[model samples]
Target: MRYFICALFFVVSAAHAQNTTALPEGAASPKATLKDISWMQGHWSGEAFGGITEEIWGPPSGGSMMFSFKLVSDGQVGFYELGHIRELDNTLVYELKHFHGDLKGWEEKDEVQSFKLVKVDGKRVYFEGFTFEKVSNDEINIYAQIGDEDGSAEEVTFNFKKE
Candidate 1:
């Protein structure tokens, strides 16, 4: 029994260690990062594609942030998306999953669209081909490059103002 307990302890510790690996050299710790984009948290609304678009962001917590987006037109929801901004493999990454208005998921349950953070500068955060630019105290412009089936890129832009 004692030997079994010791083996279990080592296994659990190894698993925990893998999940908490330190950031790479020159990488900012989570506590010291993402603060530059604090201006993004809040309820924002705007018009897009003939629809009313809404994005809600929560304050940073646990070295991560969460947000949700929804679009409604003619009193019907078009789609919904949930996103996470977190530290992974010593880098900031944005991951998103989409769902239809009826809550049918678009991606496989185990899959997500991952966007690696490229840089952050004075009121802007760039991730892979996407960007979040703060146009004003209460306004932001987001540009996203979604890949199409034929290996092409499609641009989607949003200009939102704080609600």
Candidate 2:
């Protein structure tokens, strides 16, 4: 009976191990590739609607990108945003979550926003847009409309340089 129990335990352990997926050999580690996004690695400060805004983006675990931003002014909080970026299925994908100061929790989150590289005016540019916001090489814009039930959007432009 003891032998049978031992054998059963071994079988179960082996089965569980086999179900685990492993990364392919020679594939770039996520951490290493995510570090490549270092181009956006910095602390940014800006102003919009009389509020002071700050944003930061950096490498995440397993070759992913992580970002967080917040806006505040006059001792009042405005908004906050967080996101992650990674290359999946041969395409760059981004997931984002946004929250308003008055809201109790995340107001919105989406993972379908994707980006692709394109050549514009002989220069490589990346573009990505979700339901209400769009980002390009030189600018990031949010669409704004009133009383649509979908919430208003705001667009902000950003330019990056190594410091």
Candidate 3:
């Protein structure tokens, strides 16, 4: 029984890591711009983590595209995110801050979680540990590798339909 459990855990962990990846140490981000991801502009909603998720992205402007996200579970707001993809040093970087339902921040006032651009393949934009895949004019998928305080990580997919 112990060996069975261990094998199961390993298989699950490997599957979770397959959808996203972190940038290699000392590797520079790939060159990209807000225009490269302009197709993400618009309002989108989806279900994930057993909840309803919504995101709204503003069109690219002034070298950046701002966005907001929220998750609702059991009809109550669970959390929120505010972020932007911006041009920096000839590359693009995704940065965001998380907040509680009441608007309390999860990170320090001056800190944000950031993902550097990794690649811009056709119909997909791969950021460090995150990916945006456009499925159609009205459908999209976002894959994210979320890490816990204990150093474990899991991949989450959010499938969104334009609204």
Candidate 4:
């Protein structure tokens, strides 16, 4: 989300470093385990940063969940993004690219921001420095945290409801 884009880019690279231990051996990968998160499909909307933000996710398919986000304020678009949660190396990775209101890509044509999966519970997931908590079948909260070298971190949350 635009609200965290700047800080997210700077801090996410350290997510893996701070969370070094991998999942227990032989554990189910997120792709295989996240079938439960199918509830995340459909359109969800919320308010933040004095704007309306919407997220639309496609059902999991081919070991991936694809999504798009749009931010609108005062009847004008702020930004947009495309993202995917993909299974890779027995793990799940959240990767995304940003765009301007007119659809101009932010990163180079082939580059994206990547955050590795950390954990997944019944209705919550932890990825890198990010957390996603499902409040209900129609409500969810997501946020990304930025950590410092001293192991301290600051996070901001985004709340949404199925729409």
Candidate 5:
């Protein structure tokens, strides 16, 4: 029993150490634009959380790239998200809002969750707690640190293939 508990502790710790990262305190956002992440444009699909996830990204336009996401589990609608990465003050910011299957928003009408840019490496764009990695022309991975009502956070990776 002692060995089992110790191994479980390490497993949980390692899970939390997966691909996402948070910005340092007082750090400034690096300059970026929709053009820098235009590679994200396309229809992508993947499996996550015991479900099928789909995302469609529109091409860069008017300083932003819009996207829509949906999750289907057990052949039923799970949730939806609408968002965009837009140029803000010559930098970039990612914003999104969640909705239920009935179109009821999870956030207040005037509220939007936002992530500030951290840096744009060769094939990866790192935001506050989210990162987008391009593996190839048809493959990409998005890592995000998601929080729960209990105030605990976990990193999730969504590996997508372009359709």
Candidate 6:
């Protein structure tokens, strides 16, 4: 009975060690460039459309930043948005996923938008010639003008701030 118990303990311990060793290499370390997105790493709570909206952002799996937005009103889920930002080919890129209330799962809606960070007055960053507007450090104002060939379209702005 003692010999059987000892062998069982050894087998269990060896299995546990093998499972722990399956963790990916470099998973415990973060990259240097990820520091640029440190400003957005937190939980932000706000109100939108008379409902409460909470956004959570964190360092991504591989040196990027993950962003998720959840909105609830009267304890009901309204909508959710998920996205990620990363630097690719010397340009800042953003990919967003959207889901309606009736959708089964999140769907990729927009194309991967790449922007060239143009410094305006050493404080503002502007990325022109895109469907989506610019993102700045001070204020969260997305200015977008769509459905115009002559560039005289309506400006749709969604504003947010640090919380």
- Writing each residue's lDDT as its tens digit, candidate 6 over 39-123 gives 5566666666457777777865575688887767788877676677666654455455555445534433443333333222222
* Number of backbone-clashing residue pairs for each candidate, in the order shown: 0, 5, 0, 0, 0, 0
List ranges where model 6 is wrong by over 4 Å: 1-34, 102-163
Q: Tell me the tens digit of each residue's lDDT in model 3 across 104-160.
A: 887778877777888898999988778898999999999877655444567778899
Writing each residue's lDDT as its tens digit, candidate 5 over 1-163 gives 1111111121222247466665667988988888789999999999987889999999999889999989898898788889999999989999988777798887788878788898999999988777899999999999877555444556678899999
- TM-score of predicted structure 2: 0.50
Of 3 and 6, which scores higher on TM-score?
A: 3
Ranking by lDDT: 3, 5, 4, 1, 6, 2
What's the residue-level lDDT of 83 in candidate 6? 70
Per-candidate TM equals 0.75, 0.50, 0.88, 0.77, 0.88, 0.50
Which residue pairs in candidate 3 have backbone atoms (N, alpha carbon, C) closer than 3 angstroms, thus clashing?
none
lDDT values for all models: 0.67, 0.40, 0.79, 0.72, 0.79, 0.43
Please give the range of 10 consecutive residues that has the lowest summed lDDT in model 5. Answer: 1-10
lDDT of 1 by residue, 31-119 (tens): 22657667789999999867899999888898778999998988998888888787666557777787778998777788787665667
Q: Which runs in model 2 stand beyond 4 Å of their true positions?
A: 1-36, 106-125, 130-155, 159-163
Which ten residues in a row are the worst by lDDT in model 1? 1-10
Query: Model 2, residue 74: what's the lDDT?
Result: 86
Tell me model 5's lDDT, rounded to 2 decimals.
Answer: 0.79
Model 2 global lDDT (CA atoms, 0 to 1): 0.40
Clash pairs detected, candidate 4: none
Candidate no. 1 TM-score: 0.75
